[model samples]
Target: MIRSIIHDEMFLSVPSEKAGKEHLQTVQDLRDTLHSVRERCAGMAANMIGVNKNIIAVTMPFGEMVMINPVIIRKAEPYETEEGCLSLKGQRKTTRYRKITVRWQNENMEVMKADFSGFTAQVIQHEIDHCAGIVI
Candidate 1:
């Protein structure tokens, strides 16, 4: 289903962890939401669709991927960039890392980690901010 993108107070509020079986649904929802907006969006967070959970779906160079409870473990030097959100129009000036290592869970609830750089790193940072209830 194509969930509505939330831009209210809740969207700006920090999201909670989605653990156990409930996360399966949230993951699917995030995937669905990401698919609905992938054409114009690089990624999306659960809060953007009014689901206050640490879930995000992103479009990588290879393909689309889902992250559950994603956390940035390492980061390189900071760089300023312009980023926009699906829940909000217009771009905002935000600072992001040039390279990063993130740890997250997949749809099967398996833990995984990977390295990202350049634009991909910036996109991951932006999605992480949304998981923390930040717009920019």
Candidate 2:
């Protein structure tokens, strides 16, 4: 189901966890919701749909993919940029890393690590912050 974006304090305060086997359905739901809104959004987090799970769907230059239990392993050079959230009313200035190395799991639960830069890095960091309950 495509859930509506939430903005309540309780919803933003919820802490997400590493998505396990039990969260496969929720992950799929996030992915579906992401694709459904891809025309207007770059990515989405589980919390955006009232599901407090560490899952996000990001649209990269190559394609769209889901990141499960994503964590930034490395970062470099902070930069400020205006970012908008689907669950939030408007854009805000947020500090983001220029480049990042992220470790996350795939749909099969296999761990994967990749270095992301530019816009992709920004998107990943923004979604991870949502999982961390940092509304910006």
Cα RMSD of predicted structure 1:
1.5
lDDT tens digits, residues 57-108, model 2?
9986666789999999999999989998877888899999999999999999
For model 1, the stretches where C-alpha displacement exceeds 4 angstroms are: none
Candidate 2 positional error at 82, Å? 1.3
Compute the lDDT of residue 36 as modeled in candidate 1: 74
Which structure among the candidates has the greatest lDDT? 2
Tens digits of per-residue lDDT for model 1 on 1-119? 67887888554676556655576777777778788777898998888877778888889767678888899999999988888777777889988899899999888888999999987
**Residue clash pairs of candidate 1:** none
In order of appearance, the predictions have TM-scores of 0.91, 0.94
* Alpha-carbon local distance difference test for all models: 0.82, 0.88
After superposition on all C-alphas, the RMSD of every candidate to the true structure, in Å, is 1.5, 1.2
